[model samples]
Target: MLYPATKVTLIAEHFLVERVCALIEACGGHGYTLTPVGGKGLHHLHATSDRATLVEGFDHQQVEVITTDRAKAERIAERALKELFTNHSGVVYLESIEVCRRERF
Candidate 1:
C-alpha cells in the first residue's frame, strides 16, 4: 500500500475548534481531526482546573488536516489564522506526509 498526502497541524483555544473546522471546510479541505490538549502559553496556562471534580473541559485543542494539494493546505492555514489567531491563542504549521491511499485524500 502507498500513501501520499500533506499534513497541517493547528493548535488553538478549544473554544474555537468548530470555527476552525468551518474555515478548513470553506477552504476546500476534505475534513479534519481534533484532539483535546493542554499546555501553557505566554500569558496563562491553557488548562488547569477541575469542573465539579472532572477535568476542566479541554482548554486547548489540536486540529489536523490531511490534504493531497499544497494549495488547499495553505488556504486552510491562512483562514484559520485570520479567523481565529488574532483574538485567541493558536499556532498553525504544515508538514509533508506520505499516505497509503492517494484517492482517500
Candidate 2:
C-alpha cells in the first residue's frame, strides 16, 4: 500500500542551511536531504540564460523533507518563510508524494 505524504523543498543560501534543518526537525520532519545547488531566481541580480555569465561564489543549498502528512510539511514551510525569508534569499514549496514504506519516513 502506498502512504500519502508531503515533500517540502527549501532552497536557500548555505549560511542558513543549519538553521533551516533545525526548524524542520523541530516541526516534526524525521529527516531531510541536503545538497549543494546553484541557480538563478527572480531576485537574482542577473537572470540570464548564459551560464558563463553567472556570478561565482553565490552558494546555495537544497533541503528536501518528506513528511508523513501535509500539516507537518506546511508547518515547516510556513515557519521558514516567515522567520528566515524575511531578510534572506530562499524559496520553499510543497509537493504531494507517496511512499512505499511509510515507516522509513
Candidate 3:
C-alpha cells in the first residue's frame, strides 16, 4: 500500500541553500534533498563553454522535501518565500504523490 504526501519543491538562488534546508528540518521534515544545478533562464546563465565561470549567487539551485503532513510542507515553502524570495528570484510549489514505506515520510 502507498500513502499520499506532498512533495515540496523549491528552486532558489545558490546562496540561500543553508536557509532553505534549515527551514525544512525545523519544520519537522525527516529528510530532504539538495542538488547543485545550473541552467539558462531570465536569471544568470552558467556558460556551457566554461563551467567554472558560472555566476555564484545568480545561478540555479533546487531544494525538495517530501512529507505526509501538508501543513509542515507548506510552512517550509512559506518561510522560504517570505524570508528569501522577496529580494531574490525563486519559486516554491507542491505536488501530490503516493509514497511507499509510508512511515518513512
Candidate 1 TM-score to native: 0.79
Give the Cα lDDT of each candidate. Answer: 0.77, 0.84, 0.78
lDDT of 3: 0.78
Highest TM-score: give the candidate number: 2
Candidate that would win on lDDT: 2
User: What is the Cα-based TM-score of model 2?
Assistant: 0.85
Ranking by TM-score: 2, 1, 3
> Residue by residue across 1-105, what tens digits does model 2's lDDT show?
899988999998887899999999898789999887777772354457866544554478899999887888899999999998877878888999899889877
Residue pairs in collision within model 3: none
Give the poorly placed runs of model 2, Cα more than 4 Å off: 42-50, 53-58
Candidate 1 vs 3: which has more lDDT:
3
lDDT of 3 by residue, 1-105 (tens): 989999999887777777778888888999888876664452433325453555453466688899999888889888887887777767789999989998999
Indicate whether candidate 1 or candidate 3 has the larger TM-score.
1
Error of 1 at 31 (Å): 1.5
Model 3, residue 21: distance off in Å is 0.3
